[model samples]
Target chain A: MSGPAGGGRAGSVLALVGNISARSLRVWQRNRDVYFVTWKTNLVPPLLEPILYLLAFGAGIGALVSEVQYRGEMIGYTTFIAPGLLATQVMFQAFFETTYNTFVRMYYQRTFDSIMTTPLTLEDVMAGELLWGASKGVIGCAVMMVALSAFGLLRYPHALVIIPFSFLAGLLFAGLGLCFTGIVPQIDSFNFPTFLFVMPMFLFSGTFFPLDVLPRWAQVLAEALPLTHVANLMREAALGRLPADLLRDLLYLAVATIPLCVAGIHLMRRRLVK
Target chain B: MSPVIEARALTKRYGGLAAVDGVEFSIRAGECFGFLGPNGAGKTTTVRMIYCASPVTAGDLRVFGIEVGDRPREIKARIGVCQQEDTLDPDFSVRKNLTVFARYFGIPAARAEERSRELLEFMGLWERKDARIRELSGGMKRRLAIARALINDPDLLILDEPTTGLDPQSRHQVWDRVRGLRRQGKTILLTTHYMDEAQTLCDRLVIMDHGKILVEGPPVDLVRSRVGKEVVEVEGYPPGLVQHARQSGWTFESDTGRLFIYTDSGEAVFTVIAHQFPSERCTVRTAGLEDLFLKLTGRELRE
Candidate 1:
């Protein structure tokens, strides 16, 4: 963050990586202000989407497949899918918040362009968007929690720890979605992310069934997805105890978050600053 | 003291199309300077560079004696920009818009609230302070945009065609607020194709065409130098009118139906010129900025 001095260019760009400034909070404040006015209308899909899936799949389909083999124990079908749907709720909420909503701010509203005229840099704006998106994802998880508790699927009191992990899941998906938005040329191209990437991740991330039920190569393919890591961690957390690979899961989540977030800012700055 | 903003060989290119090319000028403090041009003349592009909204492809631009190509955040802190289109926060009310904008400049909560109140009143938006953005009319939205730009009480204000879509009353109201800002000694830069607006508001202006500046001076001086003092319009061109003017050493610009002859004192020359045409053909009036504008930019329509 050096100023442009007499005979040299300003500080090199790499030196400014992860340079989240206090100004980013102002952007978050702006979005938060707007959210208060529109939150009711905004919460409908996130709250209802999972519950619909729960009643339709958990009650309707669970009667057919009453239980899933979990390690050495057999868990009720509703309990098996509850944590997975929680991950899906975070995915949908974080994805929509960053892609559709963030794109509207950047392109349609041109709010990002308006903010660019102010002292806040592009990095600040992107960081603020990421945080706001993650927050929206957490709200979605809350909606899922209410649904889970109401259905008696939250049998483990320690499943509450999954609430904290929900925030990390939100950040991960928000990072992926915003990074896609940084270089996408048009609004219609947004369908590619939803259909090609996000939709596939939602379907193949072991939300409906155990990955082990698939053949060896198909299971390997599912393991490579970002949602699979979050789903596995969330399922273990919802089972009332931290798994042995807790450290590894945390490390993977960090690896997923920091790089995508930095790259998203860099690409978005190219769209904005010029 | 040095000027508030200076541009030397400032260039901006979009691929092979040079939107702003080697433009040079300086804006003195406590004066209203304007960039006057028809559409696509690079007025907005040049001002966007000044406000750090656009990057400079080449050349030097300095704001408050700081290089504008870099140090964007520093320069941005001191200047306020009201863009051409309305970019108000649709979610916030009239008052909240200013309050939120003040926060961007890092104004504390107390100060931001105070300024929001004052600016809403100043822009005559206080009565509808709680109205959503969609509830406001076009004029009210424009007024709110101006108030938002003033949130930080910036030293240098930039308005890009602020009165373009405004009605006569709304336009006058905005002009009054701008005049009030000028009285406070704020350095103002604006772009307008309206000749009367430029003459009424700008202390000095640069007339641009095709990304190049054609003339730079005070409005009155530009009118005097380029367009003389009087103009005579004839309804139709008589035979050999072009040759006749050339032989008489007088200059005239002609359109499809009318001919405009320029002169410092048109009564004497107009009488001689009018007699050559029909008696109902000629009319004489004072030359103005519009005449000079047309003279410089030509009569062709530019989209």
Candidate 2:
């Protein structure tokens, strides 16, 4: 009869979302010491990775090609690689927040199963997971942006747009992370995705080197990637530049976001509800 | 009293295996109904379908007369389930677990807190309310799980193997709480393999084996209707003990090296057993739920 698909259900959904947010906030507040521990164990080490990359790749490789043209503007090799490092940090944080932490809740600890027997539906579970991933991504990416600014690699008007772009980066990877957890056969299956999907995207998504440097066919493959659009968006926003195909890049990311989120929620419902 | 739960030919199949096959029963209001079966006899599966956690492969199921397939949320709102495993969120403290679940049913924070505190005190967990779940023992965790299930003050309470792996002392404590709930006139549907548990707690039960009901009645009537008046259990392999008991006019059923001799005089059979197999361990007891279960479904392990 299509009865009672009323606005009342929407109010209930909002209440569900608020409940999950408050619970997470309380957990974070009570476990403030855990944030410090995670910083020491997970966040601090990766902050050094970009510095090492500059020393090893930028300085070492800059000798052969002192400067490169990206889209239109000319920039030094070290400057080109630095902003890409920030994008990589966002990707990793978003991925880790949903996949690793949520996996423990889903399988090892079974925390979500416990939540499901209550009034919370599968939709609430997915929303909580995605919200946590986005939060972690924002915190991690902000730190990286601050670090880049201190190093003089990031500029003002262009940098103003990076915050929103970082949110998109978080959404993209958070959605992908849920899909990954759903399909992965075992914990060890993550190794193949990291090495194959993550590593290649980090390397070939016009992050380290400009897309024009690649052959025409290789450039086609690069444009097909979700992170390529994200890295391009970051570079354009951070360096005050935009790709000639800006609308296409936005369209590519939007396509990735909608489907990944829908797929993620579907798989999460199957796993958590029953 | 109107029936609180009615399931007709309810079935569930995983892959090609029929886990719950054509299970049918109705639980009356304010009565304790149990599904007594060994492992893999589809107790949990049937419970899952009734709660609408798992979809029924084929059959009709209704809780509080609301059809499950058509209105799951309506049905779930009136039921509380304590699953076999303790699935509490280890990240949250004991108190947070109750309030978090209570909010799922759309309860306000103020009311949820008030009810959470009440339920925690009811379950004797008020002192440890703020402690993380990882810190609690098995028995404490199970009790907390039960408290969490009751947060909504559900009309129908369902438990799957409630006291599965508890010490005798802890089992008794949980049983007392269950009895209290029964006194409060909450309808309970539980599943367990423990015969003593069934005999002690269940007002009526269905003895199940291989996804089918073998018999159903009150605990005392089930024993009297299915088995003999008295029973003697011989522990060791008493060679020729079954034959000797039969020759002495006592009916016998041998199960797992334990011979169950049924007769009007339990002490007479015990005397025969003691005189014939003096070295063997034997006990003379009233025929109870265990004998009825063994008589309906043989002693072979289901799994």
Candidate 3:
């Protein structure tokens, strides 16, 4: 085979896409089988996380504060943060799945090495991982939505759209997490991204409060985070308000997901295809 | 009628160093072939190229009459590989491992189940089909790896040190199953540092060191040609015996505390050494593949 110098940029990308086959779904199937085996433990976290956040921040913290102004309307603090919790769930589920879980499979378990010996290529394995990571996000969002809706924190049919939206948001964060997984020297190196990237997004993605409260520079920085758009979309959907800015948020996520996913696959191929 | 695998000047280079430097060999359809070498001797690298797990740096490599680089998926689908490392899925049980691996080959679920049962039975893992991976012993895990490799009923099986870490009983068990596969007309390619394993399993073998083949032939022929009919070992270094052996133009090697002398007639050499060095201990035994291996590769620790 010719080295990287022989193939042009577009040609190599086309070749990469061409190498991916339906066999990738087998990787997804493998992960799904494993998830089901310990599903009892898996279900507990997503189900209770949103409720705890609602009780602590919504009931306890919301009791002291009056109605918060969101989208120029007075709304309960619990209602305000419910959609943000859904957005964070999407982020956490996909990120953790692709980062820690994928690393273990690739490095420790040698799962990727085993799969490569079959008809499946590295590209197929990464594609399957991205899809599976996104699927985890979708599953977590569904469970959290059920818990949030029980407390009357979510609107009817509009809130249902968050399930599908979570998949897209999931792909974005999964891709982002996989990029880090590719570059990190070891498992312990994940602490860098977890603290510097994920923790900041968790607290400042307008999850607990509106972005208007932050400093002007900080508000712009928050808007740049992928979780910010995810939270904005979830909040609008939960409140049953179909704002025109919905397309802007959707377009931003859709556009960002493709490159990050592609780059994630590319970086992983460099690590694996040696 | 054609060879199952062919490599002409096969080379695999990582950065400035070449792991497999211009090696050439071909494997026939039904014979059991082996690449014998020490650690970092490029045995695993050569097999990796044949199975398309690693990209060849420069070579004309073909498997099943197809260029490996052009259509790896086609080559890989028909070839089963048991890598040197334990690549079995720790998440699945004995049976699920085979069934899940079958999905990668596009094997239908019904067929996968049927094949899984057949393989587990063949490998003697049927009883532990539902047991978790961690619960199984090391031998069981290796057997399960072999069973998983056979899920596709591949025409050629490539095993890289299949019994490296197994106990003697476990190693013999794996060897028996491998021989069984060969009896069914499946071609096999194996690489191992264990000379006895190669002597037992390989029909045609090559001794490799520093990524180059030193010798290639059947095990018995290699021993007879490189290491004569028998070997005489004396317990300690006897300088007079060594001088006499050299002056007589005998083929021998000396180490710190032992001396090995090779001869066609074990009794003659043993009698002479015993007569000359009455106090020195000596034993004459038939030469084997290990003698030829050490003679060719030298007895040095490889990292």
Candidate 4:
């Protein structure tokens, strides 16, 4: 490598991230392409969990509440809960990459220390990591979204918007993923947070049922969780029928995402440099 | 031209203990300066401050005449550092490793490619350009690290113990490359505990012990000034050698019974050693940097 003897602005902070991210993406695809294919290979199995629930819980239990009406319309039980499952997968995959993968690169691999010795500063490091997380999340969510659409569960005429909404929903989880990485000392610490935070959200974030179906007090608690807002916003956007409380849900998730991201970046800088 | 590196009272403290105490030193343009110290003598700490990786705890430190206390990036941009540890990315090939590091300094892609090839060839790794980092040998890795540090055509190069772990063959190869750079008039600041390496590569050096400077000067001059013109080294531990020499009207210091008797008459000293200590193993030798270091720092190992 030659020194910046003929120095250029191309090595500016922003340019460095863009260049490294571009190179890293190629490395990721070549090295981690197997991981993507492996996740895809097993993806068929995960889809079965929600499909079985819809068939058994929706079809089997629809007989009891066979004729529920809302807004002068009658909807099938399976149709009501399928979108929630899709959003749950987005949260799951996004958070999984952000926590375990990021923790390894940050602590175990010592990759940031190598980069920091270059012209790139701490901010560029954080940006590059976040960009990687977002790209991974987008890939996983896009795959699942296509699979869900194939099942004839949801429809969107403006299908391109689904990509951005999925990215935003994935980013919200990515932010929280980094926040968890900052405090957890080891990869093992990730398991408890996943069990405590991720598992509960997958179970209780109105994924398997409507929020109104819960008791009033339980409904209030669920509303404050970011995943619930993400699931609600996504279900509305995918179905092309904005919910009555759509503004509130979207605003709540937007607020939560910004602070979580800022906090995560702050903690990462402190941890890496320390 | 400005001094290549400058520092005043630079110190680094690990909690309460100072690894590098109030040390002050500087190097001017195109000079090969070295820090000769035993392990834990804070040579590594001093090198880090010049490279602007480790923070200065209390004193002023500058690189390329820029105050590293505030403008580290500006200082770092003009210089290159090869840290003590191997931090190369294992996933990258030899060629990609150099090119990627160049890009981090904002070198253009096309220019970076040309430089990477030139450096890989210079370090005798062009044949292994496509090899992964894990596939390279220890010596190859060290050469690559040195090559990578030079990629930016840095005004100053800071090497922290460049050849400590290499075998003799690899060490000689590295020494040749470093000597080639020195001939190009690139200022180099090096730190090593190996006395031979400091003696061979450095024009002037400072011997540090316990975060303090014990002595500093050109290698040969430092030896001549400290230990006289010549030294008679009697290898085996001599019985009462210090007393024997002093009583014999000669000046000497005994290190674990190895007598280093300094005098202008080297042949006369050996004659006296052979006659006085017939059972003791003896080898007469001219004084060099090692004797000078032993004299200043003593023979005891520092941790």
- What order do you get sorting by DockQ, best first? 3, 1, 2, 4
Tens digit per residue, CA lDDT, model 1, B43-118: 9999988887777888888999998756778889988889898788888888888888888899999999988899
lDDT at A237 for candidate 2?
73
Candidate 4's error at A267, in angstroms? 2.5
Candidate 3 chain A minimal-lDDT segment of 10 residues? A2-11
- In model 1, the runs with Cα more than 4 Å from the true position are A1-19, A155-157
TM-score values for chain B across all models: 0.97, 0.92, 0.98, 0.95
Q: Please provide, for model 3 over A1-274, each residue's C-alpha lDDT reduced to its tens digit, 9 standing for 90 to 100.
A: 7334556877778777877788889999999999998999999989999988888987789888757988788999898999999999999999999999999999999999888989998889999999999999999999999999899989988888898899999999999999998899999899999999999999999998899988999999998999999999999999987789899999999999988988898899888876
DockQ of candidate 4?
Answer: 0.22
Cα lDDT tens digits, model 2, A97-216, are 678777876788766656555554456567667766766777777777776776788878777677777777787788888988887777778888788898898899888899998899
iRMS, all models: 3.1, 5.3, 1.3, 7.9
Off by over 4 Å in 2: A1-66, A241-244, A268-274, B234-250, B267-282
| Better candidate number, 1 or 3, judged by lDDT | 3
- The local lDDT score (0 to 100) that residue B92 gets in candidate 3 is 87
In model 3, which regions exceed 4 Å deviation?
Answer: A2-5
Ranking by TM-score: 3, 1, 2, 4
Chain A TM-scores, per candidate, are 0.92, 0.83, 0.97, 0.77
For B1-303, candidate 4 gives per-residue lDDT tens digits of 777777788778878998888888879899999999989899987876666566677888877777765666667667877877787767678887788788667788899999988888888999999998899888898999899888888988888899989999999988889999999998999999898999999998999988988888899898888888888878785567677787877768776557778877889878877887778788877888888887888887667
Q: Can you list each candidate's DockQ?
A: 0.56, 0.28, 0.76, 0.22
What TM-score does candidate 1 reach?
0.95
Clashes of 1: 0
